[model samples]
Target: MTSSLMRKGSRPLRLPLLIAALAFSGAAAHAEDEPGSLPRSFPVATPAVAALPAAPTLGADIAGLLEQARASNPGFAAQRAETAAARERTDSAGALPDPNFQVELMDFTNQMRGGGTTLVPGRVGETRYRVIQALPGWGKRDLQTRSAAAKAEQAAAGLDAAWLDLALTIKQAWLRYYAADREAALARESLALLGGLEEATLARYRQGLVPQQAVLRAQREITTQRIAQVGIGQRRRGAAAALNGILARSPDAPLAAPAEPAALPSALDLPALIARARAANPAITADERGIDAARLERERTFADRYPDYSVGVTNNRARGENQTWDVMFEVMIPLQQSARRAREREATQMLAAADARREATASRLAGELGSAWSTFTSAQETRRLIRGTLLPQAQATRDASRAAFETGRVDFDAVLEAERQLVDTRTSLLQAEIEARTALFEIEKLVGETP
Candidate 1:
């Protein structure tokens, strides 16, 4: 063809090509939506699931499940029960010990030889009845009560820690589900875009405007996207199963995809966060209580090395004389000084161990909080970069490449590459957003609120 003829032929195609490329850009932009909503599937929605009472929203469902677990999860319920029992024991620790009752038959045996009129008696039989009570060494009972109360506090702290951990687990599982669902959707969108490009490329190849290799490349990308879709679907199912396990449901239970997590909390001062964790973190509280309990036990054990006494009032019935009452007292002395020393050493060692554990736990928790804070900040920064800079720039690149390809100034490969880059950036943004929120959940677990 002549030069002018070639230019004229290309001129007619430029408008149509530009229109198609613009449509491609529009589709890429539309592929991603508000993170809060992702389409989820029910592979085989069971009749039981369908028949349940009004289905709760995702957040509501999570909240309700957490509440249910307080009574349903065996581990949590057991810990709660232990806490209650310990609290009950604290009340009994300071109360007076139960009294002992005794009855004695004295001089009641019958004689074999009966020289007198009465054949059965050597003397008039007397019955004695008594009640006895033990008084703990001074300060021992009080120490016991204090120790019990402190241990009760420990149990309560342990339960609180378990509850916080449960919340963290739920948040992580929910985020995974959300991420998987988003990944699957993006894969499908990419597949559709590639399908459209494949059709367009085949048309141009047939017209001898583009080599057949372009058509094959588009087809290859479509197949790759399809494989990714399959993998993402599997991940979604696995994530959903894990979430259902937390909810105490069957493994195959269906769930509505969780909505976007709430935004990350405002940036926090790391030192302030560590201080909050020191004060409010349940594990630390539990350990501190353990130390108090151990110290009280050590003091009580030292007091126990003294002696406890028993006192009683006895009523005696005597046929030969008038009935009489007598008072009795007994004292128990600790003769095993070595054993007492051993007990003291055990309590001392236990107290030392508890102190060490508390320090280690606090230090570890502070370090963990710092790490989570860093990760959260990184994710937040990455998401902001993708949204404010990377995504828009990628769109512009796609648009520019499409303009070049339409005028035969660039290959179709450049436009495809730009589109893929945009999809990838969008995916990364979604993942970073989830990671940031998950880290925020971890901090909340430690600090009693978002740090």
Candidate 2:
């Protein structure tokens, strides 16, 4: 009989990778065990579990990873560069059109018709020069500047959102890797424990207390578990590689299992979380910025409907006798009324679309926040029920059944059933824990905070 099942007692890691983003972010701790809540079971005399090194402080490790990723992640780097490039265009976008200077020379002077006097040229250098500067319609320049500034702000917000999103991605990958590692460790330990049980069963069979079928069952189960071990190993490797990719490391970069976060908060204030999400969510902020830009663009289009004025000085001269310096003015009329109106309509429509998109975005974020909160709450409860009740009861049942079988008081089938129940319950507990953590991470992403 396998005397005892190992209870997971690994210290939770404090993760501070999210600290720079929001003040509430901190390392979460796991829940305490209440002994009596465990099911009725006898303690089996089993060897102490193997010792594992204390996990590194989670906060420092997570923060360091984030820093490295921020500097090294190629996708994020590209987004940052794009934001900078957008900012660079602001000044150019708002600047006035360049003034023009022109000079012309005629190869030969021709007879000129004048109102009163006959014009004569002494030398062959017939020259004309003009310097022209355009003055845009009233408010056009200011509108252009506003539009450009808004665009820059949109890009800036987009970059901020991308940075937040990258943090979320890193968090998800880390959590997945951590969960996979834990699962693999549990699977290995379970296999070893199963070997002990198999030997105990074989000893009883040799003593003629149990049938050969019990030994065969144990062997068959071990074979099935070995297949599962292969799958678990593959999963662990895949998760590690995924995490490495996010950190901009080589695909085969080795990673130790990170410390798991403590249980999710039992009672999260959903309204408050939703408020935070509405206020701080990067996607929502970006959309709002986009709306501002779109509105400004509409204003710019309206400003474009008026005509522009060009004013400058012109000079025309003969070689020696006659020279004139005159002030010249020209007007650019808005002749293509239908085309201009169509553009204005397009801008107006785009502005409306942007506004609608913002509303839709807010609604979508709210929905996601609701969903994440629900999952977090549900997972939290599931883990509580499993850890505080199901796990203990199942362990107690397994211990009692194993002891009974050893004493020849219970059938071998009872022992097998109890063992399966315990294994299934333990596995369920692990999955529940991972769900809680994953849900919490999702909430953190939505609210832009983690604890």
lDDT of each: 0.80, 0.77
Question: Could you give candidate 1's per-residue lDDT for residues 45-121 as a string of tens digits?
Answer: 43454555765454333564566555666666777888899899999988888999887756554232222333232
Best by the TM-score measure:
2
What is the TM-score of each predicted model, taking all chains together? 0.79, 0.80
The deviation in Å at residue 41 for candidate 2 is: 60
lDDT of 2 by residue, 350-427 (tens): 989988888898788789878877887888788889889998999999899989988999987888788888878888
What is the number of residue pairs that collide in model 2?
Answer: 5
Model 1, residue 394: what's the lDDT?
A: 90
Give the Cα error of residue 423 in candidate 2, in Å. 1.8
Q: In candidate 1, what residue range of length 10 has the lowest lDDT sum? A: 110-119
The segments of candidate 1 whose C-alpha lies over 4 angstroms from its true place after superposition are: 1-56, 59-65, 105-109, 112-127, 317-324
